[model samples]
Structure formats: C-alpha cells, structure tokens
Target: MTNTHQRPLRILLAKLGMDTHTVGITIIAHALREAGMEVIFTGLKQTPEMVAAAAIQEDVDVVGISTLSAGHTRNLPKLARLLREAGAGDKLLLAGGVIPEEDRPLLEEAGVDRTFTMGSDTRDIVAYLNEWWAQQLAADA
Candidate 1:
C-alpha cells in the first residue's frame, strides 16, 4: 500500500551486539525492499548507540533489530532510550530473532514496539509495518 507521503517508507535493519547471524536479516531486508520500502542494512557487530545514530542519520521511518544472543536484554532498551534522547523516539522499533516468548513482554516494556520470533513470515512483517504507517498517517491527518 502507498501513502500520501510521496516517498517509499525507509527502514534501517541492524544486527546488534555479538550476534554473528546475518541470513535472517538479509532475507528480511530483501523482503522489505521488494515491498517498496527503502532498506538499509548496517551489517554486524553494531552497538545500540551506533544503530540509533545511523537510524537518525538515515531519517528512517523504522528501526528493526535482529538479535540472536543474550545481549538483547541489555541492548534493545539502551537503543530505545537513545532514540528517545535523540528525539527520534517516534520511529517504529522492531525486534526479531531467537527471542523467547517469555521475554517478549520485557522487550515491549523496554520500548520495543514489536517482537517476532525466529521463523516469522516476512510478509507479515511487511504488512504490519504498512498497517502501522497507515495508522500513523491517519493520526497525523
């Protein structure tokens, strides 16, 4: 779906912390790009602050984090707070990886807007973001 913004939605995807995984995020990046959103991949070993800085620099509409290590509990919240401090807190923050179901609520409490476990459908992720963008536009209108 298209919006009145007149530009494709921009998304920044990052592999934060010590997580060496890239396959899942790469696939997601391709899917989001295919859906007509501008996708930026930050590669591996990114700190939360670095990701936040890049997100602001890129003027992205969303910040998607892919984590597979235990550092998520430590990093996601820091990134969330950093975004708010940078005055970019309104950007959608999404996390997807090997996160356990029990920890999903914790991430949400820490400012993550959504959590998708491993094997989540890329189509669902795209649809969710599009729906969210539509809602944001409606709210702005």
Candidate 2:
C-alpha cells in the first residue's frame, strides 16, 4: 500500500483540448493540495500528447483532465489510446466538468478511471484520489 505516511501523492491536472473552463479544475487542484497531495496544473488548451507528456514529465500517479465542451465521448478515448501508446497507461486518468450521466459507462470503457459531474465537492475528488493512489501502491507492491 502507499506508505500513506510517506511522500504526498503527485497528480497532474489539466484542461484538455479546446476547453478553456478553468474554475472547476482550479478548485480541484487546490483541494488536492489541501488534502496533502502534490498537484501540477497544466493550463488550458492541451492536446492529448501534451497531457501525456506532462504526466510523464511530472511522474504523477494520476492525471485529471477537465473538459466542458461535450467532447468527452470523442476526446477521452483518443487521449487514453495516446497515453497507452506513449507508455503512460499505468497512470490513472480522470475526467471532470459537464459530463453527461449517460456517458459515464462509455467513458469508463474508454479507460477513464472516474468522471465527475457538476456540483461534485472538491473533497470527493481528493478522497477518491487518495484511495486510488493507495490501491495503486498496494497493487504495485
């Protein structure tokens, strides 16, 4: 398990593609930091390759991408594929912002670890990451 007592988990937070909404993601980054995790915020308009590259460069345990353009159905899968091809598939992929409820399963099938809709508390995101990171460490061990 994660030496829950050791170093803070590192996370990369980004706004992928043409989406420019940063309010939600900014709050999430602050929340993760408050929850004792290290967060790297990659500003807006990031391509899948850029997102994957940031994840690799930061060596984060998780990557959270925020999108509000209704492109999750199309964009997320492509991002997942790129991450896999780039050898970053082991990193957790998370999506948030304006995601339709009906699209959750499809996004999951496309390799998104979790999807957060509007109104979700930041604490929930942080808690989920903590739990997820712990589980990942346990699995690696």
The best candidate by lDDT is: 1
TM-score, candidate number 1: 0.93
* Candidate 2, superposed: residue stretches over 4 Å from native: 1-5
How high is each candidate's TM-score? 0.93, 0.91
Alpha-carbon error at 83 in model 2, in Å? 0.9
Top TM-score: which candidate number?
1
Q: Which 10 successive residues of model 1 have the least lDDT summed?
A: 1-10
lDDT of 1 by residue, 1-141 (tens): 224365678999999988988888989999999999999988789999899999999888899999888788889999999999999988999999989888888889989999988999999999999999878777756
Candidate 2 C-alpha lDDT tens digits along 46-124: 8888888888888887888898989789888888888889888888899999998999999999899889898998877
Give me candidate 2's TM-score against the actual structure. Answer: 0.91
